[model samples]
Target: MMNFTNQISTATDPAKIVDELAQGKAEDYNIGFLFVSGLSNTAMAEVIALLRKRLKVDHLLGCTCAGIIGSEAEIERLPASTLILGKLPGVKILPFSLNQTQFDDFQQVDDWLQFFNVFPNENPKFLILPDPFLFDMHEFLSGLNQVYPGCPVIGGLASGAMQPRENLLFINNESFEEGIVGVALVGNFSVSTIVSQGCRPIGQSYIVTRAENNIIYTLAGRPFIQVLEEVLQKATARDRLLAQEAIFLGIAMDEYTHNFKRGDFLIRTVIALDQSTGAGVITDYAKAGQTVQFHVRDAETATEDLNELLLSHRKKEQNKKPLGALVFSCNGRGENLFREKNHDISIIQKCVGPVPAAGFFCAGEIGPVGGSNFLHGFTNSIALFYPEEETAA
Candidate 1:
């Protein structure tokens, strides 16, 4: 049997929030933890006092983020908090945190693996939460891959405007700005991830007829700069405005093409556009013949993207659909980023039915891409949990 429970609270006191969640927890939970954060700095002692006082568990782990999300509201927006208690038998759980100085000393992740020397559990799926201030996210991902090739990594940068100088990050009990805190689940328990990019491209797909390192110089045998101008020239004044606001590039995953369904595109952010040469720089390293398209994100695109993810999930041939979903979306994507409040939270519940779900708006997101997962930004990744019998196909 698989089950989870979630709670959302507006009480500023950690203890108050914990009491509410303890009531919601299901009886079957074996191992679980609570992830908490808000605009205020609630010390570990205070957070622990609350957890120990209210909930029972073999072990617990968590960190602070820029904000918290449970239900439809943000904790920072009010005195809000979110919690999820899980039930998983025969599972391995390992938790760790790292600092900037540690990252500097270690050229490769090989250096850090020594810190987690035990390899406590085999075939572990890692859930990472870096102190946004201390860790170079790119290096952190690379290091994990080096040590545990093919391991699934999830979670996001600790949220907040908390920058290097401001210093606001929380892990377990300690607080700092420069390190990351994470929990790695190994053995017995299985993890299945769900990603809701919340976007649908409208532009026609085109081939990257030419390109240089990280920069695109041509498309469909046309000058990269020229094609871009043509797209803008053809756009309506409104589309032109939205394009300037949040334009992205979609690189259709070749893997998706094989599905014989809709085209699959792994979206990438377009970091820059050179008016002088009509070229663009993208987060994805482009290659020849790869399908590329101009994609725009707005309230509509996000709505469509989410519906697609949920629909696809329901359509899966699995014996069971998702019992619960962990929704980690971009901080820029919630009510603050959309035209409406609670849009994502509502869509999810409507489609999946309210199974216990918990997560916060993140600085960046983490999930899969073309069979390999990467930490993503401005995207929504949902890890849907189903019965082990479903995965046994």
Candidate 2:
């Protein structure tokens, strides 16, 4: 079994931050994680070079992001960079790149595993940094589910670019423009995923009685519009006002669950309403017989939901602390949604007691919900790392 050691940084001066971190006692470290905002694009080449020289790790993975998260702060729309250095004793890390052509040629898990020299029994966890522009993420995630069942693929889509091929991904000291760059961690570690979609259910759960593709015509034997109207009428004044723009629909991924709680549902945006037919349009496919509920998102609910989830994780783990965390938050969060600046990361630190963490504001986040991975918007997907076999001590 191996112990975990890490350090996190958010500094404006790339060279100075790298220099400070390079001075740390990191001789046993095998992996380096980095995320930076576009403000440092002018000097990214130098940044990567310095990281490679200083970290001296077997794997170096990162990307340019809309914002950088580190320690207890989420730095948004600013020039910032975050780095996490880890010493994974007995862990095997394999880094790879995927492009449009490789996606087509990709057929089986063996094709991916051979490059990493890993077997399915190794139980690898993936850290994905995908370019939202070129990758058909839905299809890619679906394929991974079928090929590598029960493995956690956690990460965020690279943001900070408005158009295709504008974002950058880093593997080792090299940078790429149009592909996915990620690493597979196999052996002697445990990874737990926490995906907070940032919504709480407003009304009782209902079964989708009628639906077509992404449109929901009815719920629990009534028109969708009628159900929504009832929910709205019952909502408090503040919730009603928030419902006007911030309302969402939570599709229960496990329909059999008797009580659908906060994390049980996969939250999707309520895009539009068809008054003529009393149907509701959702961002994802809605099928008959699935459980559904209306959800609302405001600063208060978002804050409470995040805090509750983090506290629950703490209770489950009891006295054991996590080594670090990687947070993939939505671009819609931050001051745009909360009145405060360090809202999400601050709450995480409050519950977990300030673990070494780093991440970015993603255009779309990727994590498992109801035992499967999906591309989600307006979510805070976090992965907590644990040392190997801690109970034996």
Candidate 3:
């Protein structure tokens, strides 16, 4: 059987926070995740020590963030901490940490297997937290894809720090301000991932006819800017107004997919446009023959996108309700973008039936889209955990 408990405390003192978290009936939790926000390094360390002594969990992993999410609410820019303890029977929890040097040294599939002491056949799913300033997340994710092939990798970049060594990562009794800390879960558990980029298509999809790297010269044999203007002319008043500052480009992940729609393409920010050359530059690369579309984002679109994805997940997994979830939402979200507190976590609980959930607002969220994991911004990435047998049902 699998069980999870989630708790949150807003007490200013570390001992008070730990005391509040330790109030519930103690279970033999095999794994625990702790997310802290607005806490000093000294206080965070003390809280970790107290939790270790109080909970006595064998495996513990987590990090600091700008905001913390719990089962009931989300606290942003406040001195808060949330803990999630799980009793996962028949699950193999392998916790590991990688320094910058070790991360750079890994070059092959065997290197990863040897370092993690696990095989690809184990079908492990990963939950990772890496310091944004110190690690090359793109390279690390690419290596995991090459090594694990279709395995799901979920989590986020540690936030709430302006520089390196400011954000803390926790693994068991140790903590670090740099590098990456994560765990690999193998056996008797299943994870379903949802990655909502929080943008809706604004114009008809068009094929890229000319492009170089991240710059697009033409779409459907017309200047990219011209196509963009035409799309804007045809858009609604609200959409046109949003396109001024909220415009983005979506690149279809699968070329073979004929009809592209919402969630079909990878959303990337439109960084700049060269009107003189009638070209546009996006955050990601574009190539000829690729499908592209203009997208716009706002509070309404973000809420709708998240709701649609969550409802779809619930419908698909009707037989096996998730027991818990780990959410990684972009720091750009929360009350800043939604104009209200607890928007993401509240919607999650409403859709997922209030399952034990915990996470933090991340610098960048990580999850799979189109069978490939990519780092995303202005997004919400979630990992839903359930029994393995339920996955087969």
Q: Which segments of model 3 are wrong by more than 4 Å?
A: 389-393
lDDT of 3 at 389: 43
What lDDT tens digits, residue by residue, belong to model 1 across residues 1-393? 667767776666666766776775535554454556653554434765566546665555555555565644545444456666666666656667778776678865556667765352366677766655656776667666667766677776667555663435444445555677666765554566666665556446678977876898788988776776688788778777877887777777672363322226677788888888678899867888787777777777678878776766666733244666667778888776676677777887776656567777787887765545666777877766665534410
lDDT computed for candidate 3: 0.88
Strongest candidate by lDDT = 3
What are the per-residue Cα lDDT tens digits for candidate 2 across 1-393? 333344445565778767765666557568777887855455776778877876667788888889888866788888777777777777778888888788887777777666556665677888899998977888888887776677788999998788887788889867888789998888777887888888888878999999999999999889899999999999889889889986799989888899778789999998999999999999998899999889998878888888988898888888577787888999998888897888888888888866888889999999998878889998899988888644210
- Return whichever of 2 and 3 wins on TM-score: 3
lDDT of each: 0.65, 0.82, 0.88
User: TM-score of model 2 relative to the true fold?
Assistant: 0.92
C-alpha lDDT (0 to 100) for residue 238 of candidate 2: 82
Root mean square deviation (Cα) for candidate 3:
1.6
Candidates by TM-score, descending order: 3, 2, 1
Q: In angstroms, how far off is 216's CA in candidate 3?
A: 2.1
What's the lDDT for candidate 2? 0.82
User: How does residue 384 of candidate 2 score in lDDT?
Assistant: 84
lDDT of 3 by residue, 1-393 (tens): 898889999997988999998887377888899999998888889999988888868798889889999988988988899898888899988999998888878877788999988787888898999889878888888888888877889999999698989999989988999989999988878899989999988778899999999999999999999999999999999999999976999888887888776678889998999989899999877899998889999999999999999888888887457888999999999999999989998899888866999999999989888777788999999999987745521
